[model samples]
Target: MAKKDDRGREGEERAARYLEERGYRVWDRNWRCPQGEIDIVADDGRDLVMVEVKTRRTDRFGHPFSAVDRRKRERLWRLAHAWMRAHPGAARGRSVRIDLIGITGERPATAVLEHLEDLR
Candidate 1:
């Protein structure tokens, strides 16, 4: 894989571990459908969280979370519903939440990370 791709994966791994450490039960990683891929799918309490992880070596352009614009967030919601539908009862009556996890720095383990919940 390209260095950037590898770094991105590393960031995702870090994010997944971070979420798990915070008491979130991770259901899936890199979940995909026709719409697109969800970096992580984890549950907190009764809500299903669809995570979008953005990683960069630095915040030269902007914060990693800044990459997820409003349009991208909307797309994430669509993908989240698609995943829920495919899983049948997994999301029955439960709320679906969109989350963004941004990791900055080459070493994701020690990188600065931020988590934003409930985009919409």
Candidate 2:
């Protein structure tokens, strides 16, 4: 795989560990529908969180979170609903939430991670 792709996969793995360490129960990784892919799907007790992970070797352009623009957020909501429909009662009474995990560094395992939860 390309170096960039490796970094992204590493970032997702690190992000999953980060969330798991914080007590989030991760149920899915790289979940996809016709719309797009949700990097991570987890339950944080009260809600189902759809996570978007963006990894950058450096911040020369901008923070990874900047990639998740308003249009992207809207798309995530659509994908979240699509996932719920596909999974039936998996989300029962919990609300759906969007989260962004941004990682920047040469090594994703030791990269600086910034997590923005409950994105709007």
Q: Model 1 — which ten-residue stretch has the worst lDDT?
A: 65-74
lDDT of 2 by residue, 1-120 (tens): 898888899999999999999999999999988988989999988899999999999999999999889999999999999999999798988898999999999899998999999999
Q: What is the C-alpha lDDT profile of model 1 across 1-120, one tens digit per residue?
A: 799899999999999999999999999999988889999999997799999999999999998878888899889988988998899888988988898898988698899999999877
The TM-score of predicted model 1 comes to: 0.96
Q: For all the candidates, what are their Cα RMSDs to the real structure?
A: 0.9, 0.8
What TM-score does model 2 achieve against the real structure? 0.97
lDDT score, candidate 1: 0.90
Worst 10 residues of 2 by lDDT: 87-96
Question: How many Å off is the CA of 78 in candidate 2?
Answer: 0.9
Badly placed stretches (over 4 Å) of model 2 are none
**Model 1 misplaced regions, further than 4 Å:** none
RMSD of 2: 0.8
